[model samples]
Target: MNKKIGLWDLVFMNVSALFGIRWIAKSTASSFGLGLGAIPAWFIFAFIFFVPASLICAELASTYPRDGGLYEWVKEAYGEKSGFMVSWLNWTSKLFWYSSFLTFLMVNVAYVLGKPELAGNKIFVLVCSLVIFWVLSAISTKGMSFAKIFTNIGALGSTVPTILLIAMAFIAVIAFGYKPASTYTVSTLMPKLNMDSLVAISAVMFGLSGAETTANFVTEMDKPEVTFPKAIMISAALVAGLYVLGSIAITMIVPTDQITASEGVLVALDQVAVALGIGHWFIRIVAFGIALSVFGAIILYIASPIKMLFGSVKKGVFSDSFTKVNDHNIPVKAVYLQAIIVSAILLITTLLPSVDAIYNVLVTMTALTALFPYVLLFKSYIKLRKTRPNEKRPYEMSKNNGKAIAIANMVLIVCIIGIVCSAAPVMPSLGENIWYEVQMIGGGLIVIFAGLLIWKRFTKRTGFKESS
Candidate 1:
């Protein structure tokens, strides 16, 4: 028998995949420019978006605990063509998403070296990104056993620092009497219903995602039908709770004006340490922790999606060579291919006019592309429920088709909203630049079309006719 993944390991794996503290900074920094309002916004999105998506994903994963995850479920419900597209979007979105993670890692590295200004130096950021990407890529090819070490460390990096920050925020406000930059009134907690707030929803949605990605590894667990749902529920609660408290902690220290998404966590750490009368060196230690957390998440993400996508090669969807696996059962060639594509993207985006602009665009594009798969995922869940009502599920979201379908529709509605808002500019500066909108929306369209073209070529080679 293959060695089974432990429940704690699975929980940490999901946490490392889904919970990056940089998002706390990102959300508090941009939370619809609402400051304290972002706190309640996290709760709102978690309820409307994260909770339902988690439940639906858990049901789908438990019912079909297979290797390819959403690819298998989607192909079962829709067809091979739809499954391939969903897998493609999931894989491609990671390429853009890697730029954001790489940027976060390097920014914290700059803070660690006591040269925070270097965070904005494009050349510095680019070199560090390349080195880190290649290093993680090489490590990933060694397989999940090696990757899990970082993920377990990442779970510590995420939870311990976040809890420390939250505790420090309380001390700073309650003991030291430092005035918060934002208020904590009822109206202030409520998010404003505006274009800015709409865009902020996209960020929250992005943060709450990766539950589906966890499905990709269900087959690695012992009694996955039981283990997968438990791990997901535990990690989901932990991640969502941390995000809310973590955002509150960030806003308590870092002034809204000084907070940039890329560097907000460092700013919060620096300010809180000073406010608490701790030496500045504390910030550097925390910065190193944040980097480890992001690195762990990146390595796991680096391997999961490619494993799912390349699994299609078994069905003859691609050349036989793409199915080549290392001694560790990882698809080495596909991983290298993903690395080259991301490296090229990282290199190209560095030449763009503004690093900030490029970062926001990459994030928005990732959010937009990421949602397309979830849209299909929710659809697959509902369809599978109706069509396979008798399918044995260790954890069913609801036995009643009406309840399951209603929750599935709720997820779909949020995905549509997220997709629409994600295509708009999140910052005032980018809002003024029409090309930001062009790049955000146009880039999403181009990626979707690229998937369609790939599907067409696959069909031509295999003589498989996709349903119109």
Candidate 2:
């Protein structure tokens, strides 16, 4: 093994990928009726979904240890058709997520420019999103070297501003005597078993996801079997803690009613600055930092998923041109294809009522589609443990197969429940709108169905067989 990446390197990479400050905003917004109960909701999902999913990923990575993450594991357990479905879902989910996330970036950029109202203007949003997405897409084709620089800057952007937000929130509440917008009592902290709360809890899964992205670097680790497990546990704890604390910080400052999913972080930061007797300059600075982080994250989403999809599948999965890479080792054709699809999504979202509405629908769709793969993932883990009992696993999720399978099933159940709840409306304006409901449930089905059609067509052309 080259052993280039150590435990800390893996830990930080996981943290950067898993922790997005924008998620704090989205989570707090989703916690609409739950109030402070959203904090415990984070812990609940972290245990049932995030933590177990990480362990399953760790075991899968160690056992397979090749480049493909979800695709390979699902393929070995099911077949190439299942594998392509996972990859297709994984890739397509990011397109919706990119719209939601990039719109968030533009929302913050509006704050930075002192034009907060522009965040809601569809034309302004559309123009800025297209420009930023294409510019980054062009840079991504240059090579990974350029993208790595932005990635490091983005990691800092996500971390530093989050720490500052959490600290400032407490300081405003304690030292400055600014009363928290919501009360956090024992009763208030208990998550309700209602539709709204379940919707919010499902959104938490989005915040804690991407832990498996770390598995791609398995080859660079020293004693990856031992190191991967330890790193995932530590990073999982850190990511979960930050999400809970950050969500609390946001709710503490911004009143629940005023919080917008896309702009809640900016709102909370503004409240913090006002309460601390600081200038709006502080808000602008942090907004700018968050925008940079969003930029870096956008680049990663654009390139990594397309790259992984191409890397995991055979040549016939897509046309030959789509599989070809340029001299810089960039999948130019695939990247361009993703950019076009995402652009179409962005354009179609103009029909949405507001910036918040656009974000809510896209994110709801993202959560529902994104979590479905975990169903297949958990199934893969259990099936592999039984069918390939003697197979080498660098870091098994559990020594006892019964215990491991149980844990996987538990995670699988949580995913199913979360996916169901995610179909509910996240914003009040959309609560009564039948179209919004259709968009949520209907959009997810369309994505999944499209993937199936493509997979069947490709598999037939390739003459792929289960045993092969």
- Supply the global lDDT for candidate 1: 0.77
Error of 1 at 69 (Å): 1.0
Worst 10 residues of 1 by lDDT: 27-36
Per-residue lDDT tens digits of candidate 1, residues 1-468? 888888888777677667767667666654334456678777677668876787687777777777677788788898888889888888888888998778778888898898888888888988889888988888888877766677568778877888898999889999999898776779777776666566667878888887776665655677765776677667767777788888888887876656777777778878888988899899889989888878777987788778878875326666667777889888888888888988887876775565555565566667778888998899898888888878887667777888889889988998899899876555456534466676677767887898888788778888887564
- What digit string (tens of lDDT, one per residue) describes model 2 on residues 1-468? 353899999889888878877767766663433556767777777777777888888788877887678989899899888888898889888888888888888988998998888888878988899888888888889887656677888888988888888999999999999888987889867876666666766677877877577776776678876888788888878887887898789889987667777888888888899888899988888889888888777886578888888878766878879888998877898888888988998888778777777777777777878887888888988899888877877777888888988998888888888788887654456444567777778888898899888878876887876785
Clashes of 1: 0
**Model 1 stretches astray by more than 4 angstroms:** 1-14, 31-34, 138-144, 213-237, 326-332, 351-354, 390-394, 427-432, 466-468
Number of the top-ranking candidate, with TM-score as the measure: 2
TM-score of each predicted structure versus truth: 0.88, 0.93
Candidate 2, position 154, lDDT: 85
Instruction: Give the clashing pairs for model 2.
Output: none
